[model samples]
Target: MTKPITILVVEDEMIIGAKISLLLTKLGYEVTGIVPKGEEAILYIQQNAPDIVLLDIHLRGQMDGIDTAREILKEGHKTVLIYLTANTDEETFNRAKQTRPFAFLSKPIQPQELQRTIELTVERILVQREVNLQEDKPLPQETNEELMLLQDRIFVSSKNKLVKIFINDILYLVAERSYCQIFTKDQQFILSVPLKSVEHKLQTAQFLRVHRSYLVNIKAIDEISQNYVFINKKAIPMVETAKEELFKRLNKV
Candidate 1:
């Protein structure tokens, strides 16, 4: 079974903490524990190392949420920190900003907001995992298994299973050594094949080779500059020749 994302809730109010834990559980996350103090939160994190820490900025102890976050980073723990704040002054906001938290949730958290925040955080975690894998290990050449492409969608391996990704949903692709990372509107997939291989299989006029390492969908282009094309607000490098070709394809006055 897939291991669910684990979280540690650090809220001083027992009732609020319990409510948050229950909500998290219902959202399919594993709540490791709920601690009411920064000191206990730190101690629990030192051993548990949950994937995320939901910290309330105001606490009874000497260490506040920002202080706890600093200590966690100081201890070399790279966990996503989400701050919960009922009220914030300039000084507290500055201090919290210094910790570089993933997000901030106001008190009386709405279920939809919490769910959206966690979902975005999970996507970030997945992307970071792919980057770490690329840095830590050498990517092998094309695997024996090939990506299954259909008229409108493609299937790629993810978590030991084939996940369907519609062709129209693709934003762009980035080549890293022998691996290609396929990007869609909300998710990303890494395929053990070269960029050229995937491009050939795509076989569509909508997808253009914007750069040596990038293949972008024409419909997803938000802006085009001299040296880059923006897709979903992400700047992708573009070569001069490819830029000329892209301009030729677009209708301009």
Candidate 2:
């Protein structure tokens, strides 16, 4: 029998942490434990390496969530991280982004959003496991129509088969109602999933949501103006707040 995915909840508030644990259990995942501090979380992870970690940003201990994530990586843990934060400030967001979390969940979490995020994360984790197992052998032909997201690349369905697209190659994504269009330098691909779903899968700091309908890769941007960002000579609209944040992120001098 295949082992069930294990998760650890590192939330300071016991009530909220317990609620999350209950939800995970209902979703058919094994909750390793719920710790209230980053110190205990690190110790628990050392003892029982969970497949995923749901970490809260503002903890009651010496280390905050971002610091804890750094320590986890420093210790060579392969567990996937998903951050929980009520604070949406740019400084906190940027610090958390530096750790490269699998996803970010706001406080007072919605059950459906949590479920979708975990499900997508699990898919990526399982795909990575398969790739690791087959490292010494040839990869099998892709027959599934579902898109597969990896750490640095994604397998997108195209012409009845899956095609590998490096994440860096993707310039931006535009949401068209229920569909999302991914634009690269020389190609474009349409996905059946919504923009939010794609954003959840992208854990890198390179991509930023410039508007409700657009997610742009900062590295691929050619120029930024007051109202728009230019990529490959294509102008994409940006919100005021997003533009300000982007300006702060870029080097001015």
Candidate 3:
């Protein structure tokens, strides 16, 4: 039999925290602890480690959620950090990405969303482990530029740290004022890059720039109508100019 996934909930809101904890248990995960602040959460992890951690961005006490996540990652624990927050602004999302959490869920999370996220995160962890086993040799040091290709499964470097991301696990990429919001099948990742810049890095056939503000992976697209394209469960608009190009790209894909 497989061992159950263990999760720690670090949230300030008691009532909502309890609700999420209950949902996690219902989804067949073990709730290690539900902490009400950042400092306590850190201490709990140091004492007893869990498989994953459900963290809230608006944490209480001296440290915020981001700080706690950074410290935890610094400790080199493989626990995947799933950030629970309502913020989606460019600055906030980029700051959250620096920690390189495994997943991100928006506020007012539905039960289905929460459960699917847990499943996907666990699968991602397994994939990473498999990839790690393939090559015993360590990655070389000192590289200036990176050429990453996001496919069914992918691994990329962020801040000199190697992070594996499953592309089929992604939903869409929303271009913010100066950053990009990478939404996955059950999560989101915000990166520091312009839409045009990231656009050039991708193979034009797989990723489509549906809107001036959105660049979506064609394979992850579920539906496309006259005006909008569906990425995972979210609807993103498609302007007239990009419509023909989008179809051509989709066909080529």
Candidate 4:
């Protein structure tokens, strides 16, 4: 059986903390514990590492939520952190930004917003686990420049290092005779794999195979003609079947 996702709430106010814990329980997450101060949160996390930490920016003690998150992240813990803050000031925002929280939730949180954030966090965690497993494997020479897809981005093997590229940055992908070429706004990368092989792997909602030789980002489409789709001023041939599919996917209004 799959274990429920564990959560730790770190809020100074007792009423708010209790409410959050109750809501998490109702949402099917395991509420590990609720702590008032950053110091207590650190201690709890050290003893029982939860899958996610819902940290408030303002706390009861000297160490605020941001400081606690920083310490947890600095220690290389696998726990995902989400900041719960009513303080949206620039200074506080910059400090929290340094901690690299998975997502930020404003105070007086709605149930739908909280649920959505948790769902996205779970997706990211699952994707990270898959990427880590792929990274542990030995690289084959024939597939030197391989790409690992994640929830929001992809990791590409480049010069013996993994380079992170967000899906939003990608413009399109072109199928060469033997390899697949990935084009972003700044540079292009060639993966040592056939187009068919990549099509199965790039099975995301955003990417579409407009033709046998091209996979285009739906958001990157600049213009559409009868026979082609323009992306970054490059025309990619659109087959009759794919063109029909693309039009169906587009919003009517």
Which candidate's TM-score is highest? Answer: 1
Number of residue pairs clashing in candidate 1, backbone atoms closer than 3 angstroms, sequence gap of 3 or more or interchain: 0
Q: How well is each residue in 94-192 modelled by candidate 3, as lDDT tens digits?
A: 999899876677788789668767876775555444334433545444222343665555545544665667765656666644455566666554454
> Any idea what lDDT model 1 has?
0.85
**Residue pairs of candidate 4 with colliding backbone atoms:** none
For residues 146-223, write the lDDT of model 1, one tens digit per residue.
899999999887766779999999999987567788999899888877889999999877889987878999999999
Those runs of model 1 whose alpha carbons end farther than 4 Å from true positions after fitting are 140-169, 172-182, 185-253
TM-scores of all models? 0.61, 0.57, 0.57, 0.59
How many backbone clashes are present in model 2?
0
At residue 14, what lDDT does model 1 achieve? 91
Model 1's TM-score against the true structure = 0.61
Indicate which candidate wins on lDDT.
1
Off by over 4 Å in 2: 138-253
lDDT string for model 2 (1-253, tens) is 6667899999999999999999988998889899988989999999999999999998866899999999999999999999998877999899988998877888998886688678756755764554354444543344223468888999886656788999999999877555577889998876666778888889667889997768999999999876678888766667799988797778652
Locate the minimum summed-lDDT window of 10 residues in model 2. 137-146
By lDDT, the better pick of 3 and 4 is 4
Considering TM-score, where higher is better, how would the candidates rank from best to worst?
1, 4, 2, 3
**Models ranked on lDDT:** 1, 2, 4, 3
Preferred candidate (TM-score higher): 1 or 2: 1
TM-score of model 3 (CA atoms) = 0.57
Q: Write the per-residue lDDT of candidate 4 for residues 155-229, one digit (tens) a residue.
A: 876556677889889888777555666789898766666767767777876778987767899989999986678
Model 4 clash count equals 0
